[model samples]
Target: MLAQVRSIGSRNACLAAGELPGGPWAARGGRTYRTGASGSTSEAITRARAIRSVTSVRGYQEVGRADLFIQVIPFASPEDARGGLTELRGLPRTMPQSKGLSDVGELRTVAPPTIAGTTHVEAAEQAFLLDGEHSRTLTVWCVAGQTVVVAALGGRSEAIRWPQLAEIVEAQVAALG
Candidate 1:
């Protein structure tokens, strides 16, 4: 899986160095998510053989030095990929506990920009109180072909906005095509 995704390289990179004003996004190593002593694949996915593999690429944005992780999960078939989308949405919400700065904010649904071959798109965001600071994560996921592409941005006091993430997600899907 590492070789497969590593082969993607910069041509599929979410953000280029110096593409934005605050210099370039630094490359971070990526890892594959698997189930077992070695890795994990959820029972549901295993049952349907829906997922082939899960992998992600990360970048640290210069301005806030925030982390941007784009996870790509491809399935055996587009139908299974669609089911995987619903499964992702169903994962238990383990919201972080607040330490009195402010409670976690409500999730707001976001409308993803149109992409060709996308059968589904689901996006939402919620803010968390981190060390008395406000931090939010915006996730935009889409289903194209037999793959599900997800972009998760978080950990910085300054939030990573939608346009930036969307650009990355679009590039990723395009590269897969």
Candidate 2:
């Protein structure tokens, strides 16, 4: 999935991953990376094999003491994108363990506001308490058309509100266009 998004060409992919100017957050340490089409790393290869025509971009930022990781993946077609979206939507239900975190929470469906002129869009949001204190929120959006734009935002739960998540998704869709 990630590998596919990475191959979508650097500039647009980076924008889609939330490397926006004067946004709520800035890239952590101004550090960012982009992978080429021929990814050699084991993780890259695994992600590449999982999704068809996958390309991805990623950006990282710090919000207070919390870290935000943003990722965007674009697929070759809507059907392929829908398949990836379904797989993502099922992750919370299929996984019993939250890596090492004990306070796992349910994944809830979010009614994504219509992004006018976007081909198709779907979204989901989830929040979980880490170590029984700090909260983490994971919000994902998938837009389908000639390419499927899969965007995700992860940060300290309380630090990011639903409105902000929606804004991020809207920005990504606009960028994808």
Candidate 3:
């Protein structure tokens, strides 16, 4: 289970495993779409999965590949978006085979391969690329109040998926509160 740090009074304390965020929220931004408590952790995971939906757009192709790929937005709060990417930088140590980070952002090695990057709202871009693998997966963690998107492309020729993911990423950011 993921550990959490908290403050009992004025002193900071580290809670044991299985501890909740504390009270209603140890961390909260604008309210999440989640309502009501889930019965179990499995249920929570299911809920999280359900909230994240996939929409197809041009540029991504799955014409022919043994392993199919999918893109996912891990979190969607402004702080979570920015902080998450910032936190991801440390993933290289925990997750080897990062292929050395790129000018875009940090990436973690996963099944079917993966690409990750960040786009300054001002600059407006999602830097991405497929690894040597035949199939590639990408996940964009955007700042809260912004859209988070990623794309899975079939092969090297599928580089076109970047532009399509970029468009949706922009729209999602626009939709954010």
Candidate 4:
């Protein structure tokens, strides 16, 4: 899926898994980046593979008191992303977490269509809050044909910076059109 999204070359991008300061993500694949020690780079990348027709770039680092993993996965089309989202929606209920954290709130629903051939679905769950500090996740699906863009953002509350996250998503819709 990550490879497929990279192949499709849509403008949407996702944040890497790790610690991040509160702010707009850098301009890498329209995504913010960070990493963590316990993060599963392989699992995230594996999930990324499920989407078709995408490309992926993974970056790992240790910044602050945590490990940083950043992946920039782009999709071929909005339809593909939507399809990917559909697949990811199932993860929240089935996938396991690191432990100690609790599910805060989750918003899962199929977004409106994008372009003539693409669709979008969004599912976000506040998987955990570290030491009662900060942790949130927002996953989006951009689908077009067999391609998909699955953007997963996870980190300490301070690290998941992307105030314009919603704007980036809206831009994705416009690009899909």
Candidate 5:
């Protein structure tokens, strides 16, 4: 199933190659970036392979620290795929911390794009301040058939290309079929 994910080009790309029907992911070149159940949560990625079964891939271009990233995964069925997309939609929330520390990040769902083949989609826009460098994260999850694709990008450049995140996910879905 991984073989059916996006493979932009086998040359000059960091490939997260694998075999199996996994969770949420991003595809670039031949690389497959596994996400939090396809979710973009520390709790999810830090857990296990089954928890992190989906995918991941870095930027296809320079956009924060390379800004954009995404994942694409195919499950055994649409139900499984919906599960993946739902997980990804579970954005980060305020976690209790020591009195001295605080979380400056904000996560919320924006409007879902009208992509042609998607069965469901959730778009999250996140923003935060850390060390004075303002960064924004745009994460989008789209479930089409038995596949789910996610695209997330942050940093100063992300706002300019934010609209492309939907385009990117739509491309991934189109590729899977």
Candidate 6:
């Protein structure tokens, strides 16, 4: 998946967990790992296989810089996708509590501006100080046919502007094709 992501553009991007070729950010080692039931312990794996349709889970991080994580879960039907979207809509309300965060600045739903004409339920959290540095995260949940895509991007406040991040998501959607 990281390879597919890196092939989308000319930018000098590489798999987060692979060897670092000499470059500006070479000294900062990056890593990626799978999460959720798909990669968890044996009991969780059994439960995931029994009841969940999650196909993949991957997380990418550029050391101290930025991060992108994606999970692909395929539903049985469009109706299931709709239900999933409704569940995702509650993210804004539950996120702060889940993270043990008290200073949630703004949490609201936003229309995802996509070039591919795929409708998505998007939510963004306003930049907030984390460990004394400003940071923000955006999550976009889209149903492409019967597959529900959950993509999240997090970055240092200065590293990525909104437009750039949107473009990255758009490219990722295109790559999914």
TM-score of each: 0.67, 0.59, 0.31, 0.41, 0.58, 0.58
Give per-residue CA lDDT, model 6, range 1-177, as digits (tens): 323333333222222333312212222332222223324343333332344344555556666776666555444455555556555555434333334333545765576646353465565655556666667777777765544566666666787555655555455455456
**Superposing all C-alpha atoms, what RMSD in Å does each candidate have to the true structure?**
5.2, 6.7, 16.5, 9.4, 9.0, 8.4
The runs of at least 3 residues in candidate 1 whose Cα sits more than 4 Å from the true structure, single-residue gaps closed, are 1-23, 34-44, 47-54, 57-65, 93-102, 115-117, 130-134, 155-159
- Compare the candidates by TM-score and give the number of the best one: 1
What is the alpha-carbon lDDT of model 2 when measured against the actual structure? 0.51
**Global CA lDDT computed for model 6:** 0.50
Winner by TM-score between candidate 3 and candidate 2 = 2
Q: Which candidate has the top score in lDDT?
A: 1
lDDT of each residue in 2-110, candidate 2, tens digit only: 3445445434354532455325566542222332244544442344344443344555564553444444545444665565556545544432255556565666767
Ranking by lDDT: 1, 5, 2, 6, 4, 3
Off by over 4 Å in 5: 1-56, 59-66, 91-103, 130-134
Clashing pairs in 2: 4-54, 4-55, 4-56, 5-54, 5-55, 5-56, 6-55, 6-56
Off by over 4 Å in 3: 1-61, 65-77, 92-139, 144-154, 158-161, 171-177
Better of 2 and 6 by lDDT: 2
Q: After superposition, how far is residue 117 of candidate 4 from its true place, in Å?
A: 12
* Candidate 6 steric clashes: 0
Q: Would you give me the overall lDDT of model 4? A: 0.41
Give the per-residue lDDT of model 4 (tens digit) for 119-145: 443435344665575676555455544
Q: How high is the lDDT of residue 111 in model 1? A: 79
The C-alpha stretches of model 4 lying farther than 4 A from their native spots are 1-84, 92-119, 144-146, 156-163, 167-177
lDDT of 1 by residue, 1-177 (tens): 334433543334344434423336665655555312133365535633333344445455544545666766666567766877777776655554545546677777777666555778888887877777777878877888767777776665474677666676776677676
Q: For candidate 5, write residues 73-97 as lDDT tens digits.
A: 5554577778756765664444233
Report lDDT (CA) for all predictions: 0.61, 0.51, 0.30, 0.41, 0.53, 0.50
**Residue 57, candidate 1: alpha-carbon lDDT:** 50
